[model samples]
Target: MTDARHIEAQIYERLNKVIDPELGRSITDLGMIAAINAVGATSQGDGDVPSYDVTVHVELTVEGCPLSQTITNQINGAIVSYPDAKLTPHIEVSSMSHDKLADLVAGLKAERKQNPFNKPGVKTRIFAIASGKGGVGKSSVSANLAATFAALGYDTAAIDADIYGFSLPKLFGVHTQPTNLNGMLMPVTAWGVKLISIGMFAGADRAILWRGPRLQRSLEQFLSDVWWGDPDVLLLDLAPGTGDMAISVAQALPNAELVVVTTPQPSASDVAVRSGLVALQVPMKVRGVVENMSWYEHKGERLEIFGAGGGRRVSDQLTETLGYDVPLLAQLPLDPDLREVGESGRPAVLNEDGALRSDVLGRTFRELAEGLLRSE
Candidate 1:
């Protein structure tokens, strides 16, 4: 018979593979595994198999969390899948005491330092999605592109840096507020992406930010006060305008590249080119332009409802003005389903399963995501 201590050690090893779906870290690593006890073992009818009752104590960051069932189920699976023994798991779940949780957050913050992204040689590729004006689907593009990047197997995080006009929480259908550990906040994971936005907070919670210096301080706090872990890609959905927010992003995230969005009209394209010109003022690089609502398809015929050539126009202007190859990255279709699904709180590029769809819209976003990453 396998010794109880050996079986207990094996159970801990199995638990190490069980990750907290929210934080994307192993339960053991997070100190969530409070205790494990292996009780009396019994032999099965087969004579060769051993069965044991295992009790696992889990301390969640928040009590009665929405994902508690998922974590429990995974833990149960880990115990039952033991090769040498048939284990019965009893998982006792509880929230960390306030003082203990505070200590945990403090240690994490001290280890992370401040604003982990600003540290030297960080691997995250930061993209600031900006538009010259509103109604050009900038937030939608940011949501879908961030979803696409996450679906494509990249560790992704998106900040709805739009502040006064935040929309990522709505688009991603995130209804739960972030769990506050002491004063630090955790970004809610939705549609396979880690997301944060002003919309997720109540008015009383948001009022805490009112004391800061407007946009710059707000973005700085989002970077420093949140536990983003180490994402492979970070996309900021900036407000539709020029100068201030762009310059703020440059000052805060020195490595962020700007991706301007515009519609297919001379009016929007004119302002779109000016948005890219902010790169010349700040040290930020103009990644490229994404022309949203470029065309509508009707009965197999491509109709330029918004007028054509705006994307090309902006691309040509930026290349000439910026002295670099500022290409037109994508021209997204005027799909009604895109808006419909988005209003339903999911990115239109993803299916009901949160996986990237194989349809035309999905392919277009995938290509755009690939092109943007390749440019880096």
Candidate 2:
């Protein structure tokens, strides 16, 4: 028969492999596994194998959390999969007390150390999508790019740094506000991307929300106050401007790369180049340029409704001025479906199931996402 001590130890080992779905950490390590008790069900040694009734006490971070069932199922599987013994699993679920939850959040924040991404030797690839002019589809590109990154198996997070004119929440179809854990906020996950935006705080009456001087303070709050974990890619949808927000991004995230978005018209491309020139003033790198609304495919013909060569012109200008190759990354087609689907609360690159679509639009975004990472 398996001894009580042995059974308890084995249960812990299995539980260690069962990660908390939301936090992406081991339940045992997170202090979620409150207790484990095992007692023989039948006679101690009826035969070669022993059957035991195992009860596991799980304390969740929040009550009625969406992922609680997923955590419990994995715990049950861990107990039932023991090879040397036959185990009947009984799982108990409960939320942590007010004081305990606060402590956990405090410890996590302390360990994370204010701003995790800006810390030295951080592995996150930060991309700030900026444009000199609005109505150039910068936010759409950011949303689609973030979704593409997530679909490509990279942990992705997006911040709508355009506080006054936020659009990530709408384009990504996120209507829920972040979960307030103690003082830290949990970013709402949508389209497989963890996202936080000022739009999410539309109905909030908190005074902490941005009022007038939103350039630096707002960006700082998004970086420090939100729990982003360690995402592989972090995309920021900056407000359409030439200076203030871009300078703020450079000051806050020194390691951030700038991705300029523009259209095929000269009017947009002129400002787009000036926007990328902010990298000259700051210590940011001009990663590349994305040309949205380049063409519309209809009836087996490519129509350049928005004129042409704006993306290439911006790329060439940035490369010549910066003395480095600022390649034109991809030319995204002008599809009404992109707007329609996005208004429905989903990125155009992803399907209703949140998986990457198999169509041309998806392929273009996938290539763009891969190219950005490869060049990094």
What is candidate 1's local distance difference test score?
0.88
Which residue runs of candidate 1 sit more than 4 Å off their true CA positions?
A: 43-46, 204-212
lDDT tens string, model 2, 95-193? 899998999888888889887888888999999999989999999999999999999999999999877678888898777878787878889998789
lDDT of model 1 at position 287: 92
**Candidate 1 TM-score, true structure as reference:** 0.95
RMSD of 1: 2.2
With candidate 1 superimposed using the best TM-score fit, by how many Å does residue 345's alpha carbon deviate from the native?
A: 1.0
Worst 10 residues of 2 by lDDT: 204-213
Error of 2 at 105 (Å): 1.7
- Report the C-alpha lDDT of model 1 over 129-247, residue by residue, as the tens digit: 99888999999999999999999999999999888778899899999888777788889999889988888888723533342267777788789999998899999999888846677
Local lDDT at 273 for model 1: 88
